[model samples]
Target: MLSEMKDHQSLMAALSENVLIVRMLLSVIFLPGASAGCGAITPVLFSTTPNFMEGLSGSCLQIPCSFNSTDPRYDITRPIYGVWLKATTAFNVTPSSVIFNSSKSVNIYQLEMIGNLTEKNCTTLFSDLNTSYTDRYFFRIESGPVRATACADPLQITVKDSPWSPSINISGGDLKEHQSVTITCSALTPCPHSPPELTWNLQQDSHRQTEKNTDGTFTTKIQENITLSDTHDGYIRCSARYPVNGGNKTAETAVTLSVSYAPRNTSASISPSGLVSAGSWVELNCSSRAKPPASFTWFWNSKHGTINVSVGQVYSFNVTEGGEFYCLATNDLGHQTSSVIRVSIKDNQVSGFTVHIILKILGIIMLYSTIILLECWFRFFKKPKMKTQEPTYVNSEMAKES
Candidate 1:
């Protein structure tokens, strides 16, 4: 009986051991997972490239994100890729997305990897970035399972300030008809990389301009030589342009130019009402109008001569004889001649009659004067001679009587 009892105890112990073994196997198959194990994937480390920078319009922007996985769990089924996108702003209503490749292994997002990535920085640009595209945005890598994420600070395209209105700077105000003029356009821009071009909206007839270098401020001047015409008046415009944030920016200014010169209008006239007499002192006057003082020269009959006069419209001189007298006036522009004037000399009509009358009066006076002289001679010396004669006669009678 003792031997049988011992045998049962042994059998029971063996059965208990077998049941414990089965329970242990079940725990391994269907129990909760361990917090740390061999198949568990470690978090991947990732960093965004070009953390901070700037870029221009219509240019490519690069966003670099490098990732490292310790468990090597990434595959074609699920890629650790990112989405390059744009945030909504005043000009835009929806957020736009540009997908980089679905590969988790690629390190760079070039211009081809995303929608027109035109800027230099990690920004994806559309063909036309309107004013509504100004907002904040960030890129995200896949998370969990493949389970690694890197977020770059919000990215935004900086719109450079457009250039200011262009203005004209001239060296001088006055020019001759076919003379040259120099004009410079002033540029106002805040963009650091690109320069702007200048052009004229409305100008006179065809002209040629020369470009000259200014200081290091990217300023250049142009010179133009042209014949001045009436069409060069009214509003004139100068314009400048440059690129900005996937778009174009332009500026313009309006101005009016007044050109002054000499010999615009010229004229001359005579002072006397009728023709002047030959061998008489007469005045020949000449005058002209111009910006500066106009020069005057007198002419007899297309013959060159000079005249002195005051600084006024009229120039006068003594004319000994007049056939045809004229004057030539000149200024910086050109010269012109005055119309001809005729002059004549006439003989006196009553001159002979006046001389005959004076001769007759003189003859009458001479006859009266001769008669008075004879009377005076008879009264004085004639009387004395008669007295002497009477005495002689008395003496002769006395002698005869004696």
Candidate 2:
């Protein structure tokens, strides 16, 4: 009887063990929350773009998000709902913590779940966001028997009062005159549905486009192909205007262009402009507008055609003769010739005065000599007759007195 009782106890113990094992297997198969020993529940995983994002105070923001679960109980075929919680990881839905809920017809904020919930896309758009909306947010997925929160990763958003400045880029070598280049201005587009308006100060045939970045962000760009000139050597500005709640926010960036070109407006001038005296010092100046200070070559249009006279910005020499003079300005890019200037050279004033004095003295001596010769001829011819006339006048006066 004792052996039989021991056998019955052993059978009872074995049956108890079998029951526990069956219970564990059933739990693993039916219950999604079942732990190890039979099966382990897989955690829900989340994939999101740009862990951090920036938003304008009165504008909107779009978050690119997707999620998946390795557990078989998390069915994607069933109807799914998404929830966004601010500053809290607890899955418990509350009026204060729940900023967005797909099931609710009306929520706390202006939000929309644009992504398809059945496809596991949790992308959401939050509109009329201000500084208050800047916080860490958590995503939750609820589908049938599965309810999971992506607590391992969260998105941190920063909202600012002003919009971000646009960026400017230039391609195809340094800016040079007559060289073709592409200039692009790009602005960040956090929400593709409401992209910022991009504009630039340059007036050219431009192309505008909105493109998606690899990091899931969108950018609106305006580009133009330009052939550089000296006139383009100034500041170029690009501005981005975003539509906000009350008004519009604007931000701008500027870049100064230093375009290298040859020489322009080349000209030559002479100092003491009127008539250049012979044997006197005269200066010929060459001037031009150039990127790199241009080198000058002075030329003289003599009887031998154009001849190189000197090489420098300023040329000084003793004026020997008069002729048409010009200058050539040259740089790495090209060369330009200035308009011809006529240089008039005259005899020195001092020498000319000396010659005039000598001529006057000669004229005076010749006149004096001619007067002496005439007086001598008059004396030789009429002296006797003059004495006789005086005597007759004296006799006539005496006779009248008598």
Candidate 3:
């Protein structure tokens, strides 16, 4: 009888202990706000990027957001609806408090929940946003028994009357002649569905694309490939046009391009152009078009070949012999030679009239000498015998007549 009583007591104690353990497990699994192992429940948290957002009054704005809850009962795979409340953190579903609701066909505000709520993506878009929409906003999620508001991580918004200016970027070192570079014009695209139109002053064919940034924003970009030249040294402008409800808003930005290139159109000119007398001084000037000012070197084409003369923009020298002269323009980029020019030189001691007078005097002297020689030959050599015979008959007749 004693053994039987001891075994029954031991079985009753064991059954009581197992019943207590079963009760604890049932409370953990069925009780509201109770976690497994009877641990503390985890609070829902929200994560968002760029807590502050600035937008154009006539344009649109995008809010990138995500949320999570550590409670195992929260099932995201169920039908999830996202809500955006303006100026209030209270979990209210009223029309005045809620600006957007993914479950509703239309909301009080022109807002859309573009993100996949089931995937915990709560990114929202607000179109035709004005200054009245500038306020703090909160996000809320509802799925089955999970209903929570991410009020701790509110998004602040500010709207302005003017639009944001576009930016220009040049890649591939410094701008230089004959070198290809990529010029990118980027404009902020808060609403990816209606990206801003981008236009630039560069005439090259460009490639256009819209990309998402790490900050959860979108940007519309146009890239152009250009081979630089001296003519590219000017201001390049890029403009962004946003299509709003009333009209299009525009903003522009400009960047100056300074291109480095070799000298071009190099030429040398003489100050006193025409004929130059020997032993007279004349000035030669060299000029060229270059990004950095070019250094000038005068060169003379002699019988032996091209020889370097003086080094300067202007060179003055006494004219002794006629020859071809040119100039060489050089810079860090490259060099160029000017066309050859001829410099004429004449004797300074003798004038043109003096040589003409000397030649005329010599011709007159030769003619007079020839006339004297002819008379002398006639008087001294041929007439001595012939004159005697002719004169005898003539003299006799003349004496009789007398």
State TM-scores per candidate.
0.31, 0.73, 0.70
lDDT string for model 3 (1-402, tens) is 999999999999999999999987776576543432212222374657577888887777887777776556787668888887786434333667777779995587778888887778888888888888888777777778877766556778888788889999999887889999988999988767778888888874566688999888889999888899998888999999988878888999999999999999999999699778988999999999998989999999898898899999999999988789999999999999999888887563346667888889999999999999999999888875644454434678878999
What are the clash counts of all predictions, listed in order?
Answer: 13, 0, 0
- Over 115-152, each residue of candidate 2 has an lDDT whose tens digit, in order, gives 88887777888888888888878787778987776665
Q: Rank the candidates by lDDT, best first.
A: 2, 3, 1
The alpha-carbon lDDT assigned to residue 174 of candidate 1 equals 67
Question: Lowest summed lDDT over 10 consecutive residues: which window, candidate 2?
Answer: 33-42
Q: Candidate 2 or 3, higher TM-score?
A: 2
lDDT of model number 2:
0.83
What's the CA RMSD for each of the models? 23.0, 8.2, 12.2
Top lDDT model: 2
Cα distance off (Å), candidate 1, residue 321: 6.8
